[model samples]
Target: RKPKTLLAGVSGRARPGRVLAIMGPSGSGKTTLLNSLAAQMDKAPGLVLQGEVYVNGEICNQSMASMRKGYVRQEDTFYSQMTVRETLRFVARLKLSPEVPYEDKMAVVESLIKKFSLAKCADTIIG
Candidate 1:
């Protein structure tokens, strides 16, 4: 069971500390590409993967540790009962280093909101 490689000869550079977006019309293989990049898909029958995927100059393999590169899908899932700040605090608690303080986490959250152009909608709670 392997995932298919959907793109070939695609090249682009995302500079460090820059925001990136993946935009396209419906059925444009955006999720497929993201799945392959994240290597987070569940095993399924009849899937065939070709070519290679490298993250931070390392090929994707079983031994690779949990990848930290942020890849947010278009329709992300979140709990309905949590406030925006609570949800973000939970996420930050899970992702940020243990030594990072609450203020640093809040700063990271604010920066991510600005980075994602989600400032205006940051306070909105998910339903």
Candidate 2:
């Protein structure tokens, strides 16, 4: 059985200080592409993924093993007792470079909250 191709001939680059989005209609492989790029795609029967993904110009396969990547699903899940800010902070600490200063990490978390308009419920717990 051959699994249908979710993505084909897709190539692009995401550089520092720039934001790139993978947008398309539903069932258009946006999530597949992101999972492949992050090397976090689930290994499913008959699902063959063949492509090259590069991060910072390094091949994903070669570097993903040692790299720390983050993937936020469309439906995010978090501890019901933790506030949004707390959840973000926890993820930032775990995913961000160890050398990144605490203040800088907090800054990034704050920026994300603002960018996503989560400020209104930043302190709300997930339920």
lDDT of each: 0.71, 0.80
Scored by Cα lDDT, where does model 2 land? 0.80
The lDDT of model 1 is 0.71
TM-score of each: 0.49, 0.54
Find the number of clashing residue pairs for candidate 2.
Answer: 0
RMSD of each: 7.4, 7.8
**99 Cα displacement, candidate 1 (Å):** 28
- Top candidate (lDDT): 2
**Model 2: residue 74 alpha-carbon error in angstroms:** 1.8
Native-to-model Cα distance after best TM-score fit, residue 44 in candidate 2, in Å: 5.4
Per-residue lDDT of 74-113 in model 2, one digit per residue for the tens?
Answer: 7656878999999999999999999999999999999999
User: Candidate 2 has which clashing residue pairs, if any?
Assistant: none
Query: lDDT by residue for model 1 over 1-127, one digit each (tens)?
Result: 4554556665455678899777788877667667666674443344445677765676767666364578776676687777666678789988899999989998888787778887676777767
